[model samples]
Target: MSKERSSRILHGFISACLVAAVAAFIILAIPDHLGRAGIGAGSATKKNFPSAKNLSSIVDLEKEKQAAEVKIENPSGQLAYFKPEQVPIPPGQDAQAQDLTLTDPNQSPDVAGGSGAAVDDSSFGNAVPIEPEPTETFQGVPDNFVPVAEDTPRGSSITLVTYPRSSLAIHEPPAHVLRRSKKEYSWIFTPPELEKDVAFWKAIYSRYDKNQVVLHHPIYLDIIYDVVDLGYIEGDMRLSELEKQHKKEKLIEEKRERIVSILEMLAQNQRLSSSLNDEEWRIKKLFDNVGDPKKFQRAAEEFGVRAQIGQRDKFIAGLKYSGRYLGEIERIYEESGMPRELSRLIFVESMFNLKAKSSVGASGIWQFMPQTGKLYLRMNKIVDERNDPIAATHASIKLLRHNYNELGTWPLAINAYNAGRGRLKQAVQTLGTKDIAKIVKNFKHRAYGFASRNFFPEYLAALEVAENPEKYFGPISYDDPLRFEMVRTAYHISLPSVAGVSGIPLEELLELNPGFSSKVISGDQLIPIAYPIKVPEGKGSIFIAAAARAPKSQRGSIRHVVAPNETVNSIAWMYGIDPTRIRQANANIRRNPSKGEIIVIPFD
Candidate 1:
């Protein structure tokens, strides 16, 4: 009896549950929302307007269901029409009107809809006022179930993504080499053309350690695009203090190199003055500390062929410079009452360098001081005979003449060439009080600056070496000879014209006339000219006659205008005059030519 009572109670409970479920189903079958997606809104569907012809009695249990139920055997069709909330969206199929609500937007187009069958919208007809079914609640896990700990990687930490699609992200533990520096690096790419490289990058990259290097593009290429994109993701790279300092040092180094390279090129081109230092060019040390000819000779040798060997043509031609001129220095010196060997001083003072100048305004082979030059030689602002090789040599010869007369000794005459007569007199006077050898021995105690200190030695060395270079040093060949003479040109005659008339090249003319920076010079300046070894030996008159062959346009209307401190004979020699003719031109030619004396000459 107790068991029957218990069974009855169970039946009553089941019946009560059945009744409640029926009522809930009826409520769910009613139209719930006003719009389309399956939420708070109701939407239109086939259930809302099913065919009236197929209307069946509500008493037919299966027919009393909501829309989407299909006919089949057993129970008339299907699994519980997936509740709109549980609809799997059929992957590609969209929601129908009854399966969804319309009021809400942002609905997934694939969500299926749901509704009841054949309901009419009316207040009094057969329309039923349907209330929305409450959404089914999600049941959570049972409290009685035991939970297990989740597995995780050893070093992994989790981060929940806060984006729309929340996901689990991991924050990896630090790497093996933890970077202590805050410094960041950036690379700048250069366009291939803009970069002037000697393939340095290619060479560096070729040997670069593959494991150590990051950028490894083979062959030369521009990676400008890649560098640009990095800027967007990381802004600018931040440098640490150490990195900034390193960059500063690198910049300084590059600037220093550029300055050095520029200066080096300038010096190499000889455009920059290095008059004081020669080692900068990698020349010999002997040439660097230069004051005498030995060092200059080394420089000449280093310059090699272009200076000496290549100059052979001109040096050989030096012997051919004849024009009724006194090219015989030896004979001339013998006549000047001086040692014939004194002529060799020309080679030392210059390399027979027709044009040589000193700092204190000495010029020509025998360098002279300006004040001293003024006392013995003639010089003017408008004229510096000091620059004329022949005239200066003549003056030198005269100076030596006076010294030879006084000293009565050859060495003293040569010494007097360097040490002036007045200074020699002072030296002799001082020598009376002291030993001459002792006085002149240590050159460091010499007067008259650098010139006096080395002057006598240069002359002596030049003389001894010229006579017996084979004995003292080694065999040496004297340069061919001084091969040039002066020829007069019509006033304002261009060098180009003289080159045209004389059949001598323009360059040859300029070389022979190094003193003429321009075509113009002193009023009676003799235009330098060169002739072959053979010219009529005694045709001074004929040569003067031939010089007159220049066109009238090239000649000055007036003949010769002599200036102050110039003798008629001096002017005549300047015009390549005959000494007899000069004496005939003016019995007093030794005196200055009067202000205006128009002397006639043969002119074509």
Candidate 2:
């Protein structure tokens, strides 16, 4: 057979098989199509299938392809052939709900909000809803503040009270109140005013940096009062002495002038003709220009002027105490709404010395004046709470709060603390601005000394020195903080009595209780009733119990025998007692008690 004819016969046989397969596939697809259309039970028709006429109709293959592409792009719209019974339920979430019987909706109880599956509550109970735990909100503390403990008494919420800068004058604290309130009130300094203050006081603080002056003495500039140096003169000579010195210097000058005139006359007459060498002429000129020794003899002594910086090693040693209180002081400052940076002011105020005192009568680590101390602290005959580190810190923070509220800026408020808010207000008012630069330049008062102008700058310097002590100062170490626990007494008691009860030495007890006045230590006064006394840490309960059992006779009493010079005030001063109390105690006796009269000193 020819190869072409055999190939033609094979192609015809293959065409017949393809036709038979296409017919079989169409016949099988009809049942599936009918079942999907919900017509499976009794429906079967050749008309339902694609007919020859439908296949002959013109169809755009490209359009069909585009439709397919659209369907593929929107997969969510694609039909899913899933049976309701086939879905897998989460295990344990209705474990017994295996049978999903379909029934009339009206016949079942509404299960929308109900427990589950319309089950009988008597057999399968409802799941109890869990109540969410409550959340507590803390105010005034920084987000990053890590409270030491959950139960510590320290973390009560503090609300921040803000005052507008313009309203400062309206809230101006009285001059006397500002003066004696808190010494650090005067010690407070903010950043903006600090720039100008640094410029003004940099020369003084630089003395410490330069090693020429290890001590920096800053006097308040009294910018707030428009009084330079607060009417304080470190040293001033009597007018008479100054006049006498002037006369003596004048006489010496006349004598020198007369000699010079005579010499000139001699030279003009050629009578003073000489062949004097350069050395001889220089000596002669020196004698002519020399002032009288007696006239200048008392110059240095006149004002008692002397460099304040001394004992560089000792100053650094004093700062060692600062390390012990740093953590505690900074914490209090933060809690009190004070900028923690100002805690370094303690280095300037007392060098962290809890027993520190100023010549002008500021006392304690915070250097509060007695008058100011009395306002915030117990500064009576028995107790001077200003000396207590913890008590003084709280007072100082309150003072800072006042300053910030009134002055509206930490810098201005801090200056108000040191220089007096009334004075600062005046400076702000007179300058018509709160700008530190303008106030520094335009504000002038005899009372405003270098200290007031440079307080914040000095504080900044101290902060700088403290922050990097190793860089500025040499190697340094600090004492361990004097850890203590406080206990309150129900009745008046002597510190010595407390010392006796605690089995601690009297000196150590006194050291721990710096708040107690000297009279209390001397047994002339008693610890204030219901006052808190500090004991070594973990010993408050022991001390309280022991103190309660202390002898009543040794607790406290005052008795004085009138001396030759013992007036009520004089007697009061001797024992650190109030004169009124002395007078009241001796009401039957004359105001001027006779010598040898015995008087009872009352404690109220």
Candidate 3:
């Protein structure tokens, strides 16, 4: 063959070879492309499969599809389909789990074929095992899984599932530890030896009303002869006050006479048991411990019947009012290292009455007489700290501490608060015993009356009632604690001026600072310099600032000499002030001021 013909044959053969190679490449690539498109049935190669990132997204999509197919079996054993979002997240999972679309990988279409043929997952390695769904029923979901309301929309109603309460763990904050007291006063205050007397006083304070009078022996308080109902006497408004008083005295005297008669009859007749009345039998039962035949006579003569006025209403009132100052009083006693229970003695003395005053010059809630009060309290024409609850509390603490120091026992010290300290000391010396129970039983002095003898027991009873008021008087709505800030006067200032400066009502200032006398409250006199006065809470600094800004001339009393014919109205008109202001400034002044007498005109 020629060289050109040979070359042409070689080129045709080369073209045929290239065409055959391209056909083989097309045949190989078509299978891979079809396999990747999931069209033909063949195991997908590692390269044909998705990348790691794409594989994650595919798994998530498969999971969401499988989750939609999964059904939760409630307590009724009925399969219920819930949205993946509606499913409660398991306890160990975070809040992000609420948004997660969960599914069973074993049921995923990617891992298992929809035609029920298992796909080989050896390339992806072993699959993660799914946890079993929780089957616990919740509070609102019933065991039978009935719909809550007939009107509830079908398939729209959701039944909440929760873990059993027993399986739930609750975490509480640790409790704060408090300081324990070193000493206890229970035995000293509520001694078993004096329980009978204390109980008697407790009955008087709680069980009986103001109209009831308990008649009992002076020494043996448990020996209650009778309880006289004086309610009838009180209800008789038609009777004059004098007539009512006389009628009550007569009734009490008649009862006394009858009791004496019974005792005398019992003493004279040994065979009186057959005809004895119900009251006589009760009285006879009380004397069963006595061995002497003439005991009735001795009792009639020595065991004089004493009457105690019931204080239940007063006690209840005291309890309600006590809330205002109880916290502060307790704090004061605690700070002084004294028995805080002693502060309840005010309930016994004056029933927490701030305006309490005794006929014998005793005053305030503490009942401090003039002689005793003068030592620790400030009492003068311009101010009386005795009427001030806070100031009086301090004074009472000092006096009580002093008494305790001198008397060496709380019983004697408390008694000294009512009776004179000298008298209690004398009784201790005479009795030759410091035991209050023994002193109460045997020691008898003419001066140491029923009140002095029963003082300690009354205190114990008051303490018990005050501590547990709900037991005596059911549920009390107490006054809120007094809120104020104490400030000392920088200068002698009138109350009206203080009110003007601090922007507090004049009446409120007067109420808070009860230590200020009428003269001080009015413009007749000025609040003394350095004297502590109570202002509304958070107003102390404001008062100080305002007082500093006030002119010196307007701060103190503005006095005027009365002309010969000057009346209160005329003097008020002359000063261009109110007549009422003049009267308030000069409380002692009546309709007219005496000639040449000094009168005060209130200045704003």
Candidate 4:
């Protein structure tokens, strides 16, 4: 063969071998590729069957997505759901998306995309932004934001939100806000005429302490003669309480006499004198508003220096104590259609002193005398409702309501609470005006004294002080409001038995049921049937159960039939009980029990 032909053959043969090797390589690579594909398929199946931990995480994510759903009530009253993230939050509130609810009942299901579905659209309409309101204090929704509504799309539902009236901010208009309409408390308007009197009392409550005595005119409370410091008398540990009081009175009397003498001298002079001392000049300056010279004599005789004990400390303490019942008191007043502010009168009457009693028999925080108390409260040997803060509060509301109905003005009515309604009516008729300022300034009667004249002013002062206690007393940790559950007694039960069964402390029971007399507390008298008793909060059911399980011997009063020779003392001696208790138990019991007559023996 030729050399070229041999080379061509070798090349052809090598090419053939190379082609065979390429074919073999292709055939071997196909299986490896198939094995890799099978491994990838196995990996895909493993992914489909996730680990338990991963499955749990997926479930949690789904739950979070569901929680973020906002429920919107449609016009048909069916609930529609949409993700909260779909709605834009108001600018300043930093409100949580979940907290936002599309509350507009007129909303259509399509607004939420569909019932129980997420929203699809990013843009609904131009959202009307709500202007934030300024608030002093509130607890519910942020006062800043009102409900925002979007303009409805022609073919689509608009996102609308409407807040309930109670959820709306109670915005107190700024001083610049136009006072065009009367408010609910329009009747409680402070007359410009009595502003000075109100200011004077406000000062007494917030500015001065008990050891200070303010000497001012009876009519014009703004008039300042002097403020005598009785701190020395009070702080004298060497003196007894009676001696300190006597010394303080003597000092006050001396100061009044000196003031009266100065007034008399000023009246006699009838003109300003350069020879007047610094003290005299100061006194003269307070009367600059009084143009007449003869008025000085009237000031001496009619408007003599009246000393007022400062009550700043007492007022602060009262503000703290008032928290205990102020909520309930306000609720009662509001329910009875009376201004809640009227409850602040207790600050003036007794400084929220539950056991306060006057020399003339006025009692309780309301200062209700026995005569007036009897009209609304139960006052007897067994129970004196006057001592109960809640009962007295109710009684006071009734009395105040009656006074308002009769007197026709809140000021006059409130004054009538201190002074008699008859006297206030007489003043209104005599003065021929319903204006409290006119009555307070001009009315003159034997019964209408300085306290009666200033009662309304004091009330206004107390109301202002109480409402803004932080402004006057700074940050105070007020006592928590009284929390209790009321349960009525099924039987005539003794307090010990109730305490024993209910598992409540005896002292707590006594404190809660203050209407119970000493006799009742001591087991000499029994709480009447169906009498409501206050127990600790969440203990009403427990108390009821305990009361039901009370033994018969511990439940009610014991009774005895009078024999032929059974005298009251003899019967009492036989039962080992007090005759007074027997008399108290039986209202119509005579000195000697008649034969065959039943007598209720007071027992625990």
Clashes in predicted model 1: 22
lDDT agreement with native, every candidate: 0.35, 0.47, 0.60, 0.64
TM-score for candidate 4, please give it: 0.61
Q: How far is candidate 3 from the true structure (C-alpha RMSD, Å)?
A: 32.0
Give the poorly placed runs of model 3, Cα more than 4 Å off: 1-183, 236-250, 290-295, 485-491, 494-507, 521-524, 535-604
What lDDT tens digits, residue by residue, belong to model 4 across residues 125-201? 11111221222111222212211111111111112222121100122231112343456466555789999999999
Top-TM-score structure, candidate number: 4
Each model's TM-score, in the order given? 0.35, 0.45, 0.57, 0.61
- Model 1 scores worst on lDDT over the 10 consecutive residues at 160-169
Give the candidates in order of TM-score, highest first: 4, 3, 2, 1
Which wins on TM-score, candidate 1 or candidate 4?
Answer: 4
Alpha carbon lDDT at 105, candidate 4: 25
- Candidate 2 regions exceeding 4 Å error are 1-315, 489-491, 528-530, 538-542, 553-604
lDDT of 2 at 171: 30
Total clashes in model 4, counting residue pairs 3 or more apart in sequence or in different chains = 0
Clash totals for all candidate models:
22, 29, 0, 0
Reference-based lDDT, residue 401, model 1? 73
